[model samples]
Target: MGKIVLSTNVTLDGVVQDPDGQEGFELGGWFHQFVGSGDLEAWTAAETEEAQGAEALLLGRRSYEWFASRTPSMADRVSSTWADSMNSLPKYVVSSTLDHPRWRNTTVLNGDAAKEISELKRKVDGQILVYGSYQLVRTLIDHNLADELRLVVFPVVLGTGLRLFGETCRRKPLRLVDTRRVGDGLVSHAYEFVSVNPV
Candidate 1:
């Protein structure tokens, strides 16, 4: 079965909103604060590695639109290799109202998201990577459909923004599979599900 990998960038305080600050959130550009610290090589390398392993992408509506509209224009950027993979990979977007996706190799799924994802897991060969789709990630987690969760935590406290986890999320336990310093102030945490859960 293919593994569902939920990966996203987060602040030290658990904010996951607008890392690039392009989304108009007040603290949107929090992740960009560390850009010129001379540690981007490690950061970009880690990102490239993940993109290399992903077989396909499973994105929510917002993330799909956000990435689809921007990634194609980044082929000449510093991490063009990663951008190429993102643009070329087959993508499945979970949306009920979205239509006319301009991104090639894109499809919209409007049925029961969890059931559809479980079916996808049984068919795909490699990882179904989920990026910056917090709502969909939470749904996958709540349904126990996510096989892995990889969080790259940046050293920042946004105090308030869209968080990685919702307040009413189920108490699912995770086993830390790996932890690494991806960069000077960035830590990557890899986690898998644990049988123990709150009763």
Candidate 2:
């Protein structure tokens, strides 16, 4: 089965909202503001490398829309460059409302997220990466489906915003497999689920 990986950019307080400042949120651009110049370059390089290695990309509805709007010109660029790197690696967007994908090599998933992911894992080789989809990540976590987490933790805390994890969720112990300081002050960490108590 392919490894299911959750990768995200999060703040010190766990906020994962628009790090790029395009979302119209007052704090949407916190990443560029807080991340040190040196750290930013390292983080980008690391992320670019990770994206190049993904066999498939999984995204939530909101993330899909955001990506679609932000990089329309890069849609073909993505397909030709990184998108073409894998074995016809497709993108699966989980949504109840979206009826079709607007980009090539993209599919809309309307069924149970867990079941769909299980089927995909059975069919694919290498790793499937989930990026910047908090809601989907939460569901994957709840179902004990996520195999690994790659988090780039920034130094600044957005006093309020959407969080990567919620307080209501049960705690699951994670085994830290790797850690490194990238660019300026950003800390990159990789953790695997050690034990999961099914909800």
Those runs of model 1 whose alpha carbons end farther than 4 Å from true positions after fitting are 196-199
Q: Which stretches of candidate 2 lie over 4 Å from their true place?
A: 72-88, 167-169, 197-199
TM-score of candidate 1 to 2 decimals:
0.93
Q: Estimate the Cα RMSD of every predicted model relative to the unseen true structure.
A: 1.7, 3.1
Residues 40-150, candidate 1: write the lDDT tens digits: 778888888898899999999999988888888987765999898888889999999987898999989899998898888898899989998889988988888888999
lDDT of each: 0.86, 0.81
Return the TM-score for candidate 2, rounded to 2 decimals.
0.87
Error of 1 at 93 (Å): 0.4
